[model samples]
Target chain A: MKVYAIYILNKAGGLIYQNDINPGLNKLSANDYLVLAGTIHGVHAIASKLKPTEFEPSSKPFGGEKEIPIESSATFSSSISVRDSTINNDVVNGRWNNPNTNNTGLRSIETDLFNVYVFQSLTGIKFILITSPNPIVHNVASLNLKINKGELNRQFDLAKEIFHNIYVTYSDYVMKDPFYSLEMPIKNNLFDSKIRELAK
Target chain B: MIYSFSIFDRHCNCIYNRRYIHDGPLLTQSKPSSVNLKNSIGDPLGVSITSLPPDNGSGDNFSPLGITTKSKESGSSSAINGPIPGYINKYNDSNASKLLFGIMYSLKNITAKLGDLASLFNTLKSFSTENFRVHFMESATGLKFVLATDNEVDNLQHILKELYTNYYLNHVVYNALSPVEFGTDANEHGKISNSDFINATDSFLTSLSVFK
Candidate 1:
């Protein structure tokens, strides 16, 4: 769970802030980093688009049809009505649950080398956390060596807490600063020190 | 339940890709020559049928027969080249690999921003979700290996290193048909088409307990 780097991208996909907490990466030009941020933002959009769409049946009422036996028609109409209502209810519930579908464009991408966690604010600002691979400590270990599920949850909980604190610090030191401009590079000393503290 | 294994050169060009299917018998889309090689190395008779074992279930001894049987069944031979049903192309579509490369590229640079004695920058190693785990390893020359497994896997760095040393370096880098390219996706000519590499990698991946 080592966080190697962190990046912040504006809603427009511009690189607003970048920090490297650990060493071991090669250097890239300033322009290249912006390009990388934009590319990730674009890919995240595409990934959101690529998410599988849930199937939903149309809820339109059945049109007029030839009369059949009362019993058969009653059963057929009742089944259709039931299906329609269920579909309608699902649509209603889905919309209520996820009003902003694109609020978080790219959630995470897991690779053999590292895990990237993306935290997108309600305002569309994105925070990307690049962390070392999560340990599979018990993959081949003895049964006694397995870490409890609660411990794993606690590790992730810590990560979430760190990200939240970073967001809070950003809002205070970077966002509210009178001199700071939107989508500009963050160079505030307070923000930097606070980030360093969080990383530590 | 391992999904696939892919090897990328420093430029993020996918050099070798093998998708593993578990819903049915382990089937792959590898060519015929690779299949023959696997048959020779894995299971000559194809009599072994491997079952899905419990994840992290310890105390059960890892049987040599079980390992060989799995290798034979999952071998990417020429005969079983059928349309894979659960097969997933997670990266190629939507240029996800390009984005992946860009993220790592910038990360390395930022990490190196501060002066360090080692002259090294740490990059992302691996990430997992509830469903799958991806293990990543990079060689000294920038070649990166990615393995996406559905179950937990251990010692993946060693596996990646072995694959790089035993297969990629020997077969692709040293092969006459392929020439290494920089900063560009490895086109078909640059891809690892060697049958021996594919066979060796298939056997190695299948031997992992996570490949069930």
Candidate 2:
């Protein structure tokens, strides 16, 4: 079965993730996905900035406490680009001091003849997966099945399974990460290795 | 009620100590005879409640110093603590209610999102995907759940707070294991043996206890 593309968008609709799985599907210009991610990123940033503060005048005596923390500039900025490939290789090679710390970027995408699956998280991370129209993705790992048509259902399931697997890996390596910036592109090579393992 | 040491009262066999205080020419007792015992580790010993019990006046049963005692013998060592025998107990007995409640509360939260938590801390917590999944096996009368991450204490604190406050008696206990060994580990009943589960239970309980 043929799987096509993967795209990850931050909660802001910015295209933080875009990758073709099959490599045969129509390819968007490299800059197009980046522009999409940037636009969404800008919109999300503005939305957060524009969020109205809830300040209700209370008749009750104040507890002598206020809610807002002084908004100083963030310590980490988007300009800081750490290569995922370097980090992952360093970790696998045992060169990095911290094993648990690293970026696990966006979810995987799968494509087949029919539809695509996009998995989302509560934190507004979007994982887009495209897969074959068959049901065989359900049992993607089953080998040497003599019947091809009978396995179609299994193919679809397998694709779903792959997405689920990818989702799990994403949450484990990426979402749970405290250091990872929100709405930023993920670049960890460990994720790449896991995906390749999943594909195999 | 200074339970400075000696906490495990699982059998409620805590021995009480009674001492005397000087009441100006007359002899009065010191603190109440309350025993401190611990079953759940990390829970705070309930407040030092050597409080005197209230007197039952025409049945009003209220006192300003604290709750009144019902003991007819006012000088009795055990009777000094309270109106009823509920002396130093956080509520009635030890505050196992709060500690176990916290654990159970956390368990509810941890179990509710078992699969979700599997990926985050599985490696540090020493569990795999298949082993973390919790599906009820009615026949074996057991359950399974994902292990929490030991990589960070903040996350464990979050889980513990939820459990201690929302604890309840649950017959089902969960264990974490590797995916490949999930079913094979369950010989016939689809659940880990009681002894195996005990080890896992001790692991979790000990973690929470120390964490507390």
Candidate 3:
């Protein structure tokens, strides 16, 4: 439940900010952090590509599908239908309930030592949090233990909430600054203090 | 549900592998209708779907014979080996196994180095991807047992221990014919091909509540 580090990757997959909030994990060199960020970015992209296609329902319908669209309206209905169709498709595809539509890519990587949660914003920026294992999983060094799914899910929700707060602070302290340039290293003291507060 | 189980020797060679294939749809929280489809089809073993026992629940309910009493309908293992389509049946000596071993080896070292510098036994227990979760356990002798299951399933440390003490020790280690260390030489890359060991493992795993 403890966050070890935080890495912010820009839209272009470059490391813009890195911070270590905890001391459990060994420290990495500055160059190593950049390499790690790039490796994670690459792995995330590759993992999304490795997503199984066979399980997904076909995007296009067969036979009468094209004919029904032609017979619908042909004028203003086309624009409305386009929007309606996507919603309908999302419902049919069972993606309407998904909380993270923008984050259809890699969500998390969990190891015995820690868990890495990737929160990709709609704008394509990524917030990666490396944290210790869930409390239930913390006693893995011992042989006998029970894993409660309810607790794990609650931790995951808490992580999302943390990201939401970080996103808000970023928008305020980093994005609102007139001197701040886009896609550059975040060096603002206010943002850093806010992040520290949130991490605590 | 458990998708596959693999064993890696001290030398990072995959000595044994088993992959299970099922026709049921992937068990993701997003799809409720597909779960209904799976229910209607019933389990291949035809065991009645029983609710999972709570933490510290009664142990007597589980039969001693291990005939899969609990149902894992809530969780599902996606397509076995998601990225690879044609490499289902190939086991042990495959590129996939080698790559898996390599990942585990490097990650184990990283975890060990990152943890307390004074302690030497800070090995990695498990890791998970978007699709499946791998549960790992290492023996004092350095034998690694890796079990890949659905994401919903949690800590299988006890299961791995059971496999090591009950099955592996009896079938492989105690048996005189099997080699002590696997893949020690160029020609004798020992694979755990013992029929007795395989049958025992199959029954043991099939009897688990998680196996579907």
Among all candidates shown, the one with the greatest lDDT: 3
Q: What's model 2's lDDT at B36?
A: 34
Summarize candidate 2's per-residue lDDT along A1-200 as a digit string, tens digits.
55555667777676765556555443446675565444333322322221111112223332333222111112122112233445777778765321111011211211122343334444546655554444443223323222122232244345556666777777777767777776687776676666656655
Off by over 4 Å in 3: A10-14, A38-113, A122-124, A140-151, A175-183, B23-89, B93-95, B120-123, B140-142, B184-190
Two-chain DockQ for each candidate model: 0.06, 0.02, 0.12
TM-score of each: 0.50, 0.26, 0.65
Off by over 4 Å in 1: A1-7, A15-116, A129-155, A166-200, B9-13, B24-117, B121-124, B127-134, B140-142, B150-155, B169-191
For candidate 1 chain A, which ten residues in a row score worst on lDDT?
Answer: A49-58
Candidate 2 on B125-147: residue-level lDDT in tens? Answer: 11101001111101111212222
**How would you encode candidate 1's per-residue C-alpha lDDT over A46-118 as one tens digit per residue?**
4332211111221322223222211112223544555566776768766211111232134555433454666
**TM-score-sorted candidate list, best first:** 3, 1, 2
Candidate 1 lDDT over residue span B1-212, tens digit each: 45667666765666565655453222211111223443522232332222223231211221110111122223223213334322222234223344344544544443344222353433444444333445567777877787765324433555666777777778777877666673264354555666776676777667765566
Instruction: Kindly report the docking quality category of candidate 1.
Output: incorrect
